[model samples]
Target: MDDGNVSLDRMRTFVRVAQRGSLSAAARELGIGQSTVTRHINELEEALGVSLLGRTTRRVTLTEEGSQYHANCLQILRLVEQATEEARDARRVPVGVVRVSCTSALGVMHLARIIFAFQDEHPDIRIDLNLTDERIDLAREGVDVALRLGPVMDDAMKLVAIGASGRRLAGSRDYLASRGRPARPAELTNHNSIVMSNVAGSEHLLLSAPDGTRLMVPVSGTLRVDHGLAARAALAAGRGIAPAHLWLIQDLLDAGKLETVLDEYDLDAVPVSLLVVPERAGIARVRLLVDFLVDEIRKLPGITPHRSASG
Candidate 1:
């Protein structure tokens, strides 16, 4: 086979199709017609002398060789694009689209402010911040950076130690004052624990004492909520006692609207992390944004974020 027979477009089509899992999906994401995408894939497979995809009625998956090729292609393609972009931006400051994702609480409570500040400084950088509790695929989801809590399993990408955000059993000022503060972890069982179950519903809680003791408490409530904002409201409204991230409840706690319970047990605050993708690992723009986020998140009153402990 002639090396010249393989075009970059064909390689790109293979990668995109692998990521999206179907020809139609690739076409949608690449903004090309399905026929064009299929043609590219067929051409690439013929050139390489191997079947790249195993297509079924419902979906498409890569063959064993295709999987390896897909991974290699991703690394190579990203590096090529990164180099080109770096050369173009060498004279200019770091500026371009930066897609960031974060959990709901921090996204609203902390990340939004930092992104606004980053935008103010880098006027040319278009920021896309996706706030969700769902785990994100940085490559597949097109995320550049993620302001995340807890641990990240992947070793390849970089995680900048943000700050510590241990959870605490807390309730609204009205709830605590009216219901009386929980003197012990076991006392949580006695309270009207509002469980933040999704619409489908389930009750769970990871509660702790100030002394570093922990307990996983099964909770039931008059309301089972899913959304963090709604849960916060439910907590604030004295709907019931629930565990909350330190950052999310900071203002309310300070305002004396919410009070922490079980001060004796040491509760593991979810380790705050800035999940940076490999593509942006060394990019000045990404580096700048990650640093700026780390700085800003630390300034968040009452939240403790730190490097996640390796398990």
Candidate 2:
């Protein structure tokens, strides 16, 4: 038998016979006839030009060369099985760690709940959520996904616009009663505003009229904070009126703790998007998680699905 003519089936049968110590027993385990098992072992021995087994009337034992070959065969077979399982898991199951980055306020107020629900549905996938106010390099940090407000700035990333949320001029009921409610956009300057120091253009409140007219009003306040959650806390404590994302304050509005002012002048809707490395978009778990987030975010109060994100 030539080396090129060696068969995997024959090698497997020989290993089984060596382990079982009897050709007939290996044949029974393999559900094959005794003659077929004998022929396989004979063919393998012929190909290798060595006697693999010392066969007697009662039992079979491995020869000196056969012992080393049997160990190598076992390793090869185990590796093949592992490779097969990995291939199946990649497509058929969500099994792996997915690292995600998100803004601190969004993560605490909304994203965390969504992730918890997602984990409940997919028990095999593990999520590591890193919440921060400062932006970080996703590739360097090994982050799998990121949820961010506004448009995708990195051209290298694959961007999917998940939804849109609008900022509203809001004040707590007690604050409004104490300071008097602003009947129009112009009156906001008279009332003290709790400004978010980290947000761009937080000092100006931009309002749009029904006929598409826009106004940029200068805003001032006694309290300034670095995070949105802190600003929200100040507002809830009746510190002053401030521009707030409706999604973040919907419960407050419902409970009458906060109320929107100048409802006639609507604020522009800001896009919320999911960002991922373009190459990772093809991964099964990444794709599934993106879809799940988009679906859930659209259902949030004051959030509307982006046209491109709508299926």
Candidate 3:
């Protein structure tokens, strides 16, 4: 059997038959006659010089080799379908649903607006936005693109560095007034603090000083929160001081409800990144949204733009 005789049509027919477990069922699914399905399978086996299917009068089953071949065929067919869609989309207007994910806080505060604006521009494009703080599997969850905050540990996904999300120590004006503002980082221990339980190190704060000095200040608080919106509410209600991503509290700061504490000190900036599924990266709609998101994200206040890099 010559390997050159193997064809995608044969592989697809084999996969369908393997999945359906019957030649008749596979033929029906493929809109072909059962005889055609039988011929395709026979051709595949003859070309490969291996018996792929265990045929029976009632049902069919895959041999060990067939199972491996089926898995590979699934991947190949998916890639081919994707490539076809991308090519077709390139010739037409960018139109389709693009699934997007973002941290809840950022989504509510900024990304929602960006997405809405994008939909307005590309009226044919629709967005399915998933908002959560939990790190999720993009491929498993069917997310086309995601705005990820902090370190993106997965080097598998294509990552574009949007910028560093600068954080600031801040509290409500009322809280600062009632408790008295801490003049230094160490003095934060005396104040009632609002801790973000979702962050890695909630018990301690690492701050950089104007003099290029860095210090790790241990902190404790009565109010421990996981969600950024909850922490923002606690801050607005004058619960306590907490380190916040500037975008998180920018509205309150503008409204004079919150004030930056220890302006001379800085917290380590979190990396703001856009993650794209490698397969979806070529789709016209996905590419449009990704480019739009990156452009708009750069304009966000408190986010420092840097050279974009892919991992």
Best by lDDT: 3
Cα RMSD, each candidate: 4.3, 17.3, 8.1
Across residues 30-105, which tens digit of lDDT does each residue of candidate 2 receive?
8999999998888888889999999999999999999888877765654554465457566788667677999998
Query: What does the lDDT come to for candidate 2?
Result: 0.83
* Per-residue lDDT over 1-311 for candidate 1, one digit per residue giving the tens place of the 0 to 100 score: 65665877878888888877889999997899999999998878888899989999989999999988887787777788789668857876777777798888678866788788888988887887889888877775567888776677868677777777767778887887788987766667778987766523236555454554567766666776667787788888888887777767777887888887766655566667777887777777777787788777877765564546321
- Order of all candidates by TM-score, from best down to worst? 1, 3, 2
Worst 10 residues of 3 by lDDT: 302-311
| Residues 144-183, model 3: lDDT tens digits | 8999988888887898888988888999998888899899
- Extract clashing residue pairs from model 2: none
Give stretches of model 1 more than 4 Å off: 1-5, 56-58, 137-142, 173-180, 196-227, 254-257, 263-266, 305-311
**TM-score for candidate 1:** 0.79
Cand. 3 Cα-lDDT: 0.87
True-structure RMSD for candidate 3? 8.1
